[model samples]
Structures are given as structure tokens and as C-alpha cells.
Target: MQRNPISRRAEAIHPSAVAEMLAMGRKMEAEGIKVYRLVQGEPDFDVPENIREAAKRALDEGYTHYTPNQGMPILREAVADKLERVNRIKAKPESEIIITNGGTLGLYLAVMATVDPGDEVIVLAPYFGPYANMVSLAGGILVEIPMVKSGSHYSPDLDRLSEAVSPRTKVIMINTPSNPSGSVMTRAELLAIGEMACRHDLYIIADEVYERMVFDGHEHVSIASLSEEIKERTITVNSFSKTYAMTGMRLGYNVANPSITKAMSKIYQVSARCAAASTQIAGIEALRGPQTEVERMISRYAERRLMAYKRLSRIKGLHCCMPEGTFYYWLDMTSFGMNSWEIAKYILSEAHVLVTPGSYFGGAGDGFVRLSFATSEENLLAGIDALGDALSRLQPTSGRS
Candidate 1:
């Protein structure tokens, strides 16, 4: 018998469902079928021209070398400034920030630095799919506290959250303006979670990548900004990917106290060293450049949001609430009497639309699917119409819709 060489840690981590769906869509397109892609978390917009120009100038200036492990000094200063102005969090550019290759790496570093073997990390259910795998890789146990869903909105329950905390709990991971669900954490919710963290003496890992895309007059709150004590316990990670359409540029940063920043830097130095020098220069421009393009993009997303809400409303068996933030609609497909993967597979085959299976997010998402409106208006109209048509053929077992 041949011996297996895969490490248990590597085996435990699953491939990202978003990536898997995108790959399947491409394979179908290769075989001559039109695949409507609504599965990825990436924005379909191009990088702003000014930011692109900055990168080009950096390359010409011979910035193709390794930067300090923390990142370029100018970019760090910009991030510090932005955190103060936009996020209301004060971070020292010199000691409290570290530039990461991307938001994903920044999140991984936070988990690696804080979680010890057997330490428990609490997270909200129906979370970003990668969070579980990150905790697994860090040898930390993941404890989920499901959010309370009322009609079209989701909120955290303070009583339930308090019940979930254990003596072994070391961290609470949070995402505001969340992906897939498009629910932005309210200021009141952040205050409650911050208070809980302070009481339990837990580290808070906050992901605020979708900060700029909030809508419906919803405010995005940085959990660290709730109080001075909360700020000391929080590790806030953000990226230029969604805001500036710089996903491919791979630039992100984290803000924490000097002690936590040092621990994350130890892993970052050996693993990634630093983000690309040219990319870091581009990030400086993204933060300091015009707000016109960013605002325009948000306006476009608002238009698409209305379109998606109207279309989803007309579908008989699917129930979805209008997203308050981000570019996704989380649809409850339980009426179809199918699991999330089954619903996703059926839609892909019948309507040629690729959507993310909600079960991939967590067990609480088993009967749902996430549809993204980050593509062109033409795609949104055609894809949702096709999805409604496909779902209409089935006789739903439940009357929830």
C-alpha cells in the first residue's frame, strides 16, 4: 500500500466555494455554453485610472524590490490617516500597522498570531467561508453563534452571544458590511460585541473590507472605535480590493496595538515578507486620490440593488431581502426542499447561472444561496430572469415563500 503524504492540517482546509463555482462556470463556457457568473466576491470594475497610473510610475521608478516587512512607509502613513478619518480608529503608522499582500493574508496572520492550539475562536454563523478553514489551519476550535434573522434583516442576539462564550474562548471574529448576506453591522451591535469582548478579555478580529459599499442610510461601524478599551483588544483588517477595484493588485493592511502587530509581523515576515512595492505605491494613491470614482461606483451599485430586489420579489419560490450593503442577495431557498449545494447545482444546470451555495458558509446557511450583483446590468437582468424561470418549474414542498 502506498503511504499518504498529505498533512492533516492541509487536508482539513477545503477549497474556497467561490473559486470552485467560478472554475465550473469557466469550464462550461469552454464547452460553448453561456455561463452567467454571479459567484465571486470580486468587483467587476477596473482599477481607477489614477491608481493604475501610480503603479506604472512606481515601476518606472525602480520599485521592483522587497519593501520592509511591514510595507512601504508612505502607504502605512496613508492607512493610518484613513483609519483616523474614516474608521475613527487611531493607529500609529510606525508601530501599529502592517501591510499585507491582501485582505486574505491579513486575516490569516491575525488568526495565526492570536489562536493557540485548542484555543476557541467564536464567529457568527453564515460567515465568509474561509474563516472556518483559517481557524482550522491555526489549530483553533471554531465556535459559531448564529445571528437572529427577522424578515429580511439579521442581527446578533446579546443573550445568545453571552451564552456561547466559554473559558477557552480567546477571540471573536467579526465582519461589517458582510459578504454574501450584505448585512452591515450597526453601531449599537458593535458596541454590544465590544462590551462582550472587553468583559471576556477576548481579542477581536474585525474584517471591514466592504466599508465603502453601505447603502440605505446604514452606517458602518468599526468595532475598535466603540471605546478605548475595545481599541486595545481589536485587530482591524481592511483592504483596497473592493473600494478601489484593486483586487488583482493584492494590497491590504491591518491595525492593532504594537504587541499584536509584532506577533502578526513575525509570521508575515517569513511567509510573505511584504506586499508588492508597486502595489503599495498604488495603495497610497487610492487612499489619497479623488473620491468621485468611488462614489460613482456606489451609486451604480444602488441602482443594481433596486433591480435585484424587484426581480427577486417576482420569483415565486425564492425569498430574498434587499441587501443593505455590499452587492449580494442571500436567498432563502428552503421552499424548494433542496440543500444549498443542490439548489446551486440545479440553477447552474437549468439557468446556466453560477451562484455560491450558502452551505459553504456554515451549517446555518444550509437552505440558502448567495447571488451577487457585481456584474453588468445586462447580466443581472438576464441571470435573475433565467433563475426565476428555472425555479418556477419545480413544485415547492414548503410555503415559506
Candidate 2:
């Protein structure tokens, strides 16, 4: 069989697991089968009234033209102000920041600006699935460091991480209130990581997209906020998606040293041109406008996290850990002696519930599954009930219990 040659970078990537599962779930729904899908991290909430109204008003005033290649000055100023007030990151809007289409593009820009072919990017494992693809697409080697479990909580094996660094290591990419594991790195842990990166002369890509999606007793401290030295080496990316339920708005930004920011902006000018003008205005309202709606959304997610934890804990032989932040539950299905994708398949076939296989995150997650609590309470309850019932009927191959 003959086929067209594809670039090695593109050929190395796999289709997104979440997107694939969602498509399958939708197909089932079209066939009149009710599938309780907990596979996505997408917020099922409405965009706040103010943000929507702001976008509409911008359109009314004829804001359809392309914004500056870097970004609309007004929005960048607002973002810089919000970072100062909220994240404690002080950067000049003109030289240190550039607006992006979303966190996806923001991450890509950061990786492209610094990484070169054969350079290494250290990724904390059980990471968001796309991190691998992004690094590969940027022609960099992806290094994986799996977290150690400490009494249901996950923490980085700092010694192991330090051992992974090499002369080729260029970046240490991280996500707090992480996507698949939902483990929020403590302040002390973050400090230690910062020190390690400094000693290794590695750049930091801090993915703080879920900064506001935290639970009680869990605080999100941006690593770049630690010190001037660390801040200088860090590229911090964030978006209006999860916090404001404005995923469709396609507004995200990154702040870094002017050198890196300039490189990213040059790429943007040749690629996306600029973020949509009206969306940038909506982003302004998202940051500077009222935050009560943000608080309400966080409160709701906290409640849903509790509901999922309680239900998952009840399943026999299935170890469930409560997430401190984010809306995911990383379930340990290793007792059944099956890989994550196999377990996911079993549950979908027998239980009619959909979840992301942890292996999608990384090889370290082979025996785990990630379920989202980002759905409605009604759907959540049903999915949890089904999951519990299905797992209870199976016994661990190890026969330890």
C-alpha cells in the first residue's frame, strides 16, 4: 500500500483521547442510548451575563477588525493589571505579554519560543494528554516524571525528577490543579521545584489555566510568583475559559521575559495574526468586571467534587482519592490487573459510563482512569452509581483483599 509522506512531527502525534471518546459517546446518544459521559474537562456552565453582553456591545460598535499582532493594547493592559492584583505577577503589557487564541495556542507558543529539536522538556506525568503532542510538534524530546502517591495524595518525586535532568533539558512544563490527577502542588513542593529548575538552568512553562478552580484549603500559587529570578525564567499561560466558562471565546495570554514574548509574538503574527478583537474586549470584562459569578462556579465545582469522591470511595476494590482542586477524580483500577484503556473499555461496554483512560495522560498512568465531575449533578449521580456497581462485581486478580 502506498500513501503520501507526512512530516515526522505530525506523524508522531496521536488523536486526542478525550475528543475520540466524546465522539463515540455522541454516536451512542444518536442511537438513542443514554451514556453517562464523564470524559471531558469542559465546564458545563453558561458564560456569565456581563462577558456575553460585553462581546455583544463590541460587535455593535463594529469591533470586527483584526487586533494588533501582539494583542489589543487595552486587553493586554487589563491582563497585566489583573495579574498584578490577582496572581502577583508584574509584567509590562507592551513587552512581556501577548494574547493567544486559547491555552492550547499559548502553550504551543511557549514551547516553540524556547525548545529546539533534540532538546528535552520535562513533563510531570499523568499530565494533560496534549502536552506530549505539543512538545513533539515543537521538535523537542518529552521527558516524563511520574508522581508518587502518599496516602491518596500525589506529590512529585523530587529526587527522581532531579535525576532526569540532562544537558539537553530545556524546559520543565507543569500544571497545578493538574488536569488528569487534579493534584494541587503545595507551596513547599513548588518552591523545591523552582530551586531544582534554577540549579539546572532550565526554563519553566507554568500552565495555570485552572488557577481559580480550587477547593477549600487548596491555594494556587503561580511558580513565577515565587521570586524575581524564577519569574524571569518562567512563561505563565492562562485563559478565560474555565474560570469564566468562556471556552468558546478563544482568549488566552502568556507573560514571559521580553525576549521569549517577542519570539512568540513573531510566530503569532505569521500564524494566527491576532486574537479576535471582540473576544479580547470580552476578556477584559471577564477580568475587571464582577467576580461573584466566578465564586459561584467554584463553589458548585467543590460540591460536585465531594459528591464524586463519596460515591467513588464506596466501590469495592476500587481505590479513589479526593482531588484537592480541579474537577477530576483519578481512580486506581490497578487491583483488577488491567491497563487503563482496557478498564475504560470494560466500563463503557458494561456500565455505559465514559471516562478517560489514565494511560492517555502517560505510561505511568497505565492502571488508572480519570473521571470528570464537570457534568451536571443528575448525570454525575447516575454515572457514579453505574461505576460503583460495575466495579463491585469484579475481583482483583492479586487477591490481596
Candidate 3:
């Protein structure tokens, strides 16, 4: 039998490790084995009651029809107000915002709208794995700039990042409260990156999906809010998934200047059409509703973060830095002799704990692994203990022991 040729674009992409491991863990659960899922960055909290009820109200009000390609006008207005009040970024609802199916798709639209064939997109290394695929889909080249690790912190190296930029560089993408590594870019770090983008005349694609998940006195600052010039050149993407535990809702949006938003709307209309109508209503409530639910969730995540980071750091052969934001622990396993992929598989099979191998993120991620703490306290304690035991039995790298 002959198989048809698939597109080179499709061939360039690989299945995401997070989704793949989540599936495998679920399969193990189906088989009656207790598998602790630590690979995916899904929040375990339930959606806030006000937001949930808003969706039901939308349905009851017969809001089931298709929404505007840009988004429901009301939601766009709500988002605009929230951006000004919360993020301190001014955006006109009519021309500067486009609602997306999710933050992931919003990133795709940003790339699709701005990236031309052979254009270079600079993504910070050890990034969320899907950014490469998103850039590839736009017929663009991906240029990775690995963040420099300084003791317990992961910080962007502006000089090196600027050096990586060339005439071919069209855009620079960054994530705050970053996925996989859980690093939150400081205001100083962001200003440096923003300066680089300005110097290079490159567009800025900012992903702040984990904006509300910051911990340990770290503040989440949207780069677009730094200045009017950068704001004009920036496209800010955010989601309700991580913040509100509304992953299934698929409600997210992007903010940019009018021309870019128009370009994104054209592609968005052809692809997603619009975020679910009811979901948009829910998003409106998420922005406008009371903050008690969000505050409660944040308090709980803070407790989990402290526990997970402390336990993971205590492992004999593993070294993990405390994440500034998000619920992921980035564990360095270079001493274990095995690369991230091999070690991840060993941990899953031996410890029954699922994790995302760092190499799946980038070459810089080769000896690292990412584990999510978005689970119960009991699971976090049990899973990290199992991981410690598994690592202790593995032989050290040559010359180490």
C-alpha cells in the first residue's frame, strides 16, 4: 500500500510531548495503574462560579449563533476595559483586539499575520514547544535564543539575543510566567528585550497567558504597557485557560495596532471564525466579575509551589530551581548520564510519574525536564518522592562519582 505525501510544513511538526504524555498517563489510569500526570500545565481548580454561570446565562439568552469574526462587541469592550484597568495598556475595542479560540491559536494568528516566507522569528529557547510549529506554519524560520540561568533564576540575555537578530529577523516572541520553565521575566529584563526589539525594528509577540499565576512577590508586567512605541509594535496574547481553569472554554484574545489586528482578523475568520459565543460571554464575566475566586486559586497555587519546589530541590541527583511563576518545576538532570528524553521515559515507567522531556522544547533543553505541580498536594508529595527515589538509583555521569 502507498501512502500519500504529506505537506512539508506538516512534516516539520511533531506531536507535543505534553499532550502525548497526558494521553499515555490517562491510558495507564484506564488500565487501573495510578499514574501521576506532571507533564501538562493544566490547572486542577474548577472554574469560578460567576464565570460559569455567565456562560449558562448566555445560552439561556439564546446566544448560540455565530459571533463576529473579531469577537462579540461586548466582550471586546470588556477586554479593552480590563486591559486599561488591569494591565495598564490602552487598546480600542473596535480596532485593536481580536478574540481567538485560545491563546495558542492567537499566537498562530500573530505569526500568520506578520511572518512572511523565510522571515526569522526569534523565540526564547526552552520555550513552549508549540511556538516552533506556529512559526513554521507561517512559512517562517525559527531562531531560538536560550535564556541564561543565574542560580535560582532564568533571565533573558539581551546582548546575546540582540546578536542573534539579523536583517532577516522580523519578530521576537516572548512568554512571561513562561511555560515549561516557569520563569517570569522581570521589568528590567522586559525593558531590555523591548529595547532590542525597538533597535532592530522587529515586531513583538508577547504571550502572557500565565500572567495571573505569578508567585513569591513577583509581578506580572505586560511588555506592551512599558511604552506607547513598544505597545504599537507589540501583539499581546492571553488566555483564560491558566488563570481561570477554563481550558475547555477556549477563550483568549490578542491586542495589537489596528492594521495588524485587521490582518489577524482575516486569517482568524478563515480558520477559527470566532471563539465560542457563550465562551466570550464567560470571558466578559471573568474580566468584570468579583476577584474572590481568582484570589483563592492563587493562594492555593502559592502553597503548592512552595511545597513542590522545596521537595524537588531536595532530590539527590536532581537540581531544580524555584519557579517564580506558573506551577512548573524545571529540573536539571545533567548528572544522571541520560538525556532528558531517556530520563523522562525511565521516570514514567519506573516511578509512574509523567513528565515532559526538556529536549522536546529545544537543544538548550537537552539535559533538563519539566514537571507540573498543577495537582493535589497529596499527588505532589507522592510524585516528587517517587521521582527522587528513581533518580537516586540511576548511575551518575562519567567522572562525577
Candidate 4:
């Protein structure tokens, strides 16, 4: 008898590069290898006590029923208020916010709501890996525009971006305090992007999961905050996972115009229905409660960022940019004349350090690797030392400066 075949969509997707590295690490651990895990993006911190208490209280009060398709009204309002206060953008609580399982879901839903088959979605290169896959799953084509590197900063090449736009362009996805590179777009960049979206009538999906994780005195400017016209065309995606260290809770929301939010709500209703009731309550407390914990976490990340940059810079042939935000350091390894996968495998096998290969993000990410600093300071330092040792082995004759 013939076996059932998987859908084209499922077959077309490749295994996640981060997940592959994680599995490799786990396999090494099973063999008693001391693996220094710097691949995954999960924060090592615990959820704040206040938010945990809120979830516990909600459970105690039996608030486990299904909520509105959009989300709990109170949590929706809180999210809207957060936009107004933190992002300086106004959104209607009842119509503009829809909470999903996490920011990943929000991104998928936004794509589903806006993109059609063969539609073009421009994504910045060295972006989060899943963005391209998500676009493909949504039946859209991803157009990558590489960001130009200036010393440590990554800025959009507006000229190239302009050339990429066309009548078929439906969306432009952006991540601030970007995932792999940790580069934040400036206000001027945001304005230029907004103007392009407006000119092309393209929707903008702004993933700001690291909005609160900036370092070195760099500020995050939301594209939606640029103007009301831009806000209408932009869907701002965020999550409690990064900000509140509640990754497992899987609670996230999107802010957009009422029409777009309504469409996303329909998709949510048909698929997820609503996020966890208790988690939504937890999210409310996270947004409304004391923000000291968030501030403390940011400070710790900043310190780790500095430590990683200092140590990684000491590597013989590897060049890393000082990230302005997020907990990752993107390293250019082209000088070693090896692709990301080769370098990643070399490090994993020779040094027992697992990192994400940049090729997983897109074509332009071929010669880079991304290391996460979301672990303890001690572990980060140890991983950097291991990486340096591995680089020496790769280029034994290249003397260190």
C-alpha cells in the first residue's frame, strides 16, 4: 500500500537551523560532551514574580475559560495603552489588538491577512531566519534587501530598497534591535521605510520583540510611531516572551488598523481561538506592574554584550560588530573562507560550542554566524574561549595580533 504524502507546504519547509544546532547540542550532552549552548534565543532568566503571581491568582480564581477571539479585553486594553505610552502610537483596544500564542503566530497571522500568492514581501537580510519561511508559508515571495554595515551599525540601503519595490510588493517586514545583527534602525531610517511603504501601498510588519532590550544608550524607534498614515499600514508585533522573560507562556499581540486586526482575528478564531487565559492575565500584570525587573534584565544583557564583544574581538580571523540591542552578536567569518554551516559544524565538533549558522537567515547570510548571549556570564565567557580555540585550529598558520 502507498503511504500518504505530506502537503507541499510541509515538504517545502526546511528544518530550523537553530533547532538543528540545539539537537546537536542535546546529542552531545547525551554522550557526556560538555556543550556550551549559545544557539537558541531563549532568555535564561525566570519570569518576574509579579507576573507569575498573576497567573497563579488567575488559576486560583478559575479564569481558564476561552476568551474573546481577539484576547481578554483587559489585556487588549493594556497592550493598547502600552503602545500609547511606550511607543507613542495610538491603537483602539477593542479593534486594533489581537493576542496570539506568541509573536511568531502574530507574524504568521499578519502575513496570512495581508499577503496573496506570488505577492512580494521585502525582508532585510541577516534577519531572523523564520521570516522567509513564514512568507513562503503565506504564499508570498520574499525579496531580500541587504543592510549595509558601517563599522558596527547595520543600516538599510534605501537605494536598493527603493529598487526592490514594485506593483506586486505587498509587505515589508522589519525587526528592530534585529535578531542576528542586533542593529536598531534609526528614526530617519524608519521614516524612509514608512515613506516607501506609503508610496508602494505595501503593508509593513514591524517585529519589535526586542524593543525593550536595547543597550549602549541606543533607543528603539517604532515605525508605526512615525505617522498616522504609516501606523495604518503597519502591523506592530510584540511579545511578553522577550520583555517579561515568559517565553514558555507563549503570549504575544499585534497592533494594526481595525480592518487588518479584524482579518487577523478571524484567522485566530479559526486556528488558535485565543491565547491562554492565565497567560493573558500574566501579560497584563507584566505591562501594568513595576518595570524594575525589565530594567535589571536589560542592564545584565548590556554587560554580557560588552563582555562577548571584547572576548570575540580577540579571535584571530573572526570579526564581530558591537550590537546595539538584543542578546546576539553577529560575526562575519568570510576571512576564514568557510560558509556558516562549516564554521558552525567546526565549532560544534571541535570546540563543543553550538551557534546558529547565518545561512539559515537567507542567501546573503552565507559567511556569518550568530551567537546568543542569553546564557550566564560564565557560560558566555567559556563559549567565547572555546570559539577562539576553534578559530586557531581552523587557521593555525594565521598568527594572532
Which structure among the candidates has the greatest TM-score? 1
lDDT of 3: 0.90
Candidate 1 overall lDDT versus native: 0.92
Model 4 clash pairs?
none
Output the better candidate (3/4) by TM-score.
4
- Clashing residue pair totals per candidate (backbone < 3 A): 0, 0, 0, 0
Worst 10 residues of 1 by lDDT: 149-158
RMSD of each: 1.1, 1.5, 1.5, 1.5
Estimate, for each residue in 138-163, the C-alpha lDDT of model 4 and write its tens digit: 88899999999998999999999999
The 0-to-1 C-alpha lDDT of every candidate, in the order given, reads: 0.92, 0.90, 0.90, 0.91
Q: Which stretches of candidate 1 lie over 4 Å from their true place?
A: 1-4
TM-score of each: 0.98, 0.97, 0.97, 0.98
For model 2, what is the error of residue 45's alpha carbon versus the real structure, in angstroms, after optimal superposition?
0.3
For candidate 3, write residues 1-401 as lDDT tens digits: 76989889999887888887778788889989999888778888899999999999999999899999999999999999999988999999999999998999999999999999999999898898988888898899999988999977788878889789988999999999888788899999999989888888999999999999888788999999999889989999998899899999999999999999999999998888988899999999999989899898888889998988778777777778888898888888988878888999899888999999998888889988998888889988899999888888887674432
Which lDDT tens digits does candidate 2 get at residues 299-397?
999999888778788787788888878889998889999998889988887788999988999998898899998899999999999988888778887
How does residue 301 of candidate 4 score in lDDT? 90
Segments of candidate 3 deviating more than 4 angstroms: 1-3, 398-401
lDDT of 1 by residue, 20-57 (tens): 88888888999999988888877888999999999999
